[model samples]
Target: MTSTPEPWGPVEPLEPALSVRRVLTLERVLAGEPEVVAGAAQLDRPVRWVHVAEAADVGVMLTGGEMVLTTGVLLAGDENAQAEYIRSLHRAEAAAVVLGLGRAFPTTPDVMRRAAERCGLPMVVLHRPFPFAELTEEVQSRLVRRKFAAVSLSEAVRTALTGLITAGAPLQRLLDEIAHHTGCPVVVTNLAHRVLATAGERPAVDDVLRDWERIARQAGGSEGDGWIRAELGGRGERWGQIMLCGYRGDTAGGRLLADRAAEALVLHRMLGGTSAHTWEEQSAQSLLTDLVSGVVPARQLLPRARAAGLPVNRRTFVPLVVRDGDPAQLERMLRLLGLPGLVAEFAEGAVAVLLSLARDQDADALAAHFATRLRTESGESRTVVAAADPRIVWDDVPTGLREAQHVADAVADSSAALDLPAVVRLRDVHLRGLIRLLRDDPHVQSFAERELDGLLCAGAGDDLLAVLRTYLASGRNKSRTAQLHHVSRPALYRRLEAIEARLGVDLDDFEQAASVHIALLAHDAQQA
Candidate 1:
């Protein structure tokens, strides 16, 4: 037995066209019995206007996307001229060509029809006598009406978004309004490409964010069906972008919605005195400061961190301290790397960043990468110091931060006189770093004073002290020290002999030289 055929589903309605289509049922033109002789498949091309041109070079007089009304008066016998006329209109991007019949060969010219077919330019012929004035008036009026409707729609969207902003609606509410108007997913992101807010059906939002890294990479060019973004901010200070995902509308309409939403969000943030970006940074800074101070236990601070959108329980934490780098640039870089972290201005001339690492990631490698990026971005004047604890527990983060801070402080103190690596760590600073940490103690201060008292009180300036520092720092190599101080060999020897005599120590003795070196490091640390 044969199965019954299934009933067909209802057809979905077509979206409204931005401009009048060439195949639009023009009642006056159709009453004259027009025949579409070529490019029937392209009859739906948009026509911005209707123009009458009897010249052979009419294409020069027209802009793109217009339907030309002609009578073939100039090319009634010449086939090449007919072909060239059709080719010119095609090059000018004319929507369609309408020819009035009974005066030019009583039918469409074979050369013009073939040319239109080759160029995919729709060609229509009126079989009966038709007035070009009537058709032009009808099409022009329709085009004007459509243009007005589009302007009205844009104004309506702007008013709605403005009202929402004036009412003090939150960011999510504003995004939701945009989504409602566009019937698509709306997203807001900072310059770093972190998703700040989203509004749409849950599944649609998830689909957009599922491959966010790829999407972010492609966001530099907004020429696709996936997403379109409108920049936010003014006066050359671009703070973020508003994106419309899966917007199934004309590009003009989608852009209108995105621009209105972006404007509303910017105004909302300005009126509220704090943006979502600023608030998030402030929250992270507060949490990090509290963690470093050890005023609250790690377990107790977990809830606050989670509320601030930090992933704490299953992540590896690396504490980093950067000297002479901008905190804002660091935050932007972190967002670009898709690494969530807390960044803030710590002490004067120092920025602290607490990086959240995934389970499989290496903290040291990431720290090195971050340091290289910082150097490349901010130049060699900046230094980055990091501490990576093998134990990835939250309880250890406070200690790690202190360690990193100490390393950074020591590196900054010594960077002026010594050439150090870009990425500094605890091992790089060694004994001098340890001594700097204890420089404030009474015993350490006393030792440093006793070891260098003679030089300190010799009525001579820091010249001899400078000589001793270079001498000790160069591993007691006289020639190397002379090269560093830009002095002759005899002058360097005399300076070294004077230093040894005043300090009451033998320069040839390794133990005595080591003691003096330690004393000098302690004094420098205390001074710093």
Candidate 2:
């Protein structure tokens, strides 16, 4: 059976001392409100009469918006205590003070006015006796209204979320809606710590994720899942954090709401492809892609990075190709380095590092340590290479990437023969020799076309072509190809038909196609 929603709680009555007008006045206050002491400036502003037992102890008793009412009995003998009392009231953000015209404070002293004026605390006096009962009733009405307003706001949130769900809203749209309703900037990051959606001063919060990583770690871990509320500035000061815990309320109602929102966001992301990426792997792959003509420099990308606070100087730097098992593994290795001045792009299943090394000796040590750490983590028996200091300009990442990939490829290819981990430099390899061989062999060019050209030409749907290349490369063995492609035996046969139709090649007749494959490889070698 479905349970009914919880009804709004009954409104609580305000304190008898305060009047309705005064509590209402607080809602309009921003900064620098006037200070009126005693009944001198009755017409100046609205006042709430918050009675205090001890005039001297008003500071501790004053919260954000109370107007202190006292008989001044505590200021009987000490001027310093009197001055301190007024100052405390001001500092505690009291709306105003009312001095009852009787007892020890029968007359408003000049010191009281000066202190109140100096500290900016308003002072008021009741000209004639007023009933506390009538004041309390009025104040209670205002309090009830305010409570209802809060409930209305909560209901609005529910309505907005329902509208979004019905309208099939995107994550970005949802975040924008939430920010609009909350009257605060909002940022939503995925489990992988990448910002998914943001509203309100997004550009200002570009470095938020990076900075928040440390904050999150201190909170617990990078994947810390909870709503954290903290005051923005000082204690009880302006801009304080009003975070909800556990992505919801610390306890009941808010918790369920926040949890539901989080789940909806997750589902939205799954449909929208806003999933967090594995940085290290993505970085390496991007670097390699840039080098191997896998991707072109996009104008849209760097602007997005800048918006996220990754201020890439894009001037003089070295492109360090950092390879490891994965992003988590690379992060661990980086921490183990125990050195400073290292920033990395963890993208495309690879780690492309940028290091600011003052000492040449330190550079060498960084490379060696990174390589050793990589080997330990990779477990793939691969030797990862860290590039030599190459002057990489913003536009030159592609060229630098090419150099990085060439060096790494040479290392990887040589690993088996040399029984050494591959960490070769591109310039160190005999590019001229490879080029000359390709130039002399015309058949190699044709072979590459017959074998690999179709893979590139298929546009986005090239997986079938890819299977064909691997199948052919493995010497036409169905079992080996099936294992490499991660397909069942029957699926392998189906993939072969798709591949053959797309490539227009007869894989069954390998003898005739061998010549064409050789020619295409020759062309690639020349380009290398």
Candidate 3:
């Protein structure tokens, strides 16, 4: 499948947060160092950066990197308070605390001094007054210098790689060297988009696929179409993402820069991983290659299969396809699948579901029941078609995927012709292909138009589908259905009667129920 299109914008490279080593310290400032503020303590500084405040609890509220200025107004009123405040500052990991020479205490409180010494936190006392703005300007200038250096370094690396490529140099050594220098996992994706090399612990493919779409979108179509774009923690499990805790000194540029570097590394390898293969450019074609070449080898498959928590040595795989639209509905279905032994991947607007081997001959029934349960939970009028085949080990995955595709396609095509409600499935068809199409056509569209025209015209198609889907979920239990919809049973009955009357189908009759069910599946397919 094609990656999601990235949002359009002018390409801006991101950079990492300023290193603690780059900041100046209070001691350095007092010593007449032109750059006075600790780099870790300075924020938004073009000169030396300092903060002077008496807020007692500034420690927890702080994000380090500041030459903390305090008038000692909040000095510990008690021995405990003094120690606690100092401890909190230490925990906040501030670069240094600079106390004004004159404050609430006659001298540096013994307790405060002890606390700072115990915590190994830096403490400074200003003997002379200095303008806060001037200090800030100096610190900011140093930060700008650091950023410029980083940019220059990044450009140098880029140019070196480009030159190497132009000279047809081997990339493996270059990647290893880069990984060593960066100290981050280095992954090179092949021209076919399969990961060809990696320098860190590997993560599962399913986990990677989860964020791949978002990464693709952010990179944008044209922005990273042929070139590289970077982002942070937006894709996969390893090198994926992590909570920043708080915004702190993290600038948007820094976050972007880290991720872009990752993207660049991946793209560079993807472009250079193999001999230029014109055919591998297509995602679909690459998918075929990954399947045929056993990119996810049988040896790796078992670990992942076990990770998925599938039964060992069990055979048979069923592929289930999820229809698109309605994110809420998609979310509900996804929630039911936190268990292992099931592998799912999103292709286009649909999610492909893989079911491991079943226990017995009732595999199809089990699969159907599992699917039906998911449908009920989602309360969506979407199609879930399953293509089942006898249990095959991972070595036989290529055949399974191809077969599943055929089954899903068949179900999708056949269901379109039915006069069903909002949901459809492959097994819903008693016959295959054209015959199934004829059976569902009227109920699929015409019948739905007749019965649901009000909702359709009111642009309440979603609401109508939800209601219909929920009705099925409740097993047509009017009381339970009423409670879910917050409507009385009488009202629900009336609606059901209206639906039956409009469609000329009686719910009580088996033939009508079967017909309506088929029709619903067909309607959903056509919409899909």
In order of listing, the candidates' clash counts read 0, 49, 57
TM-score result, candidate 3: 0.34
Measured by lDDT, the strongest candidate is 1
lDDT of each: 0.77, 0.49, 0.49
**How much is 76 displaced in model 3, in angstroms?**
18
Residue-level lDDT tens digits of model 3 in 407-463: 455555541345443223434444443233443455446764554454455554465
Q: Which is the better candidate, 1 or 2, if ranked by lDDT?
A: 1
Clashes of 1: 0
Tens-place lDDT per residue, model 2, 395-506, is: 5555555556445444433312343434445445454224333444556555566566655577743576456556655667899889977899999898777666665677
Put down candidate 1 lDDT per residue, 1-528, tens digits, no spaces.
Answer: 333222122222223552434334768877888888998888767777788987888889889988899999988998888999999999899989988887676977889999999999988888889889988888777667767766776676667667766666656677777787777888777776666667787567766766566677788885568477899897789887889997887666677668877887888888878776674565566677888889878666664555345667689988888887677899988887788788887677777888888889987787778888877777665455555353488888888887777888888767345556656777778897798678889999999999999798887638999988878777788898899889999998888888888989997999998988888899998887
Off by over 4 Å in 1: 1-15, 18-22, 26-35, 40-44, 222-226, 273-276, 279-355, 358-528
Best by TM-score: 1
Against the correct fold, how does model 1 do in TM-score?
0.53
Candidate 2 TM-score versus the reference = 0.46
Candidate 2 runs further than 4 Å off: 1-35, 38-65, 68-95, 99-121, 126-139, 151-202, 206-324, 339-356, 359-365, 376-380, 384-389, 392-421, 425-528
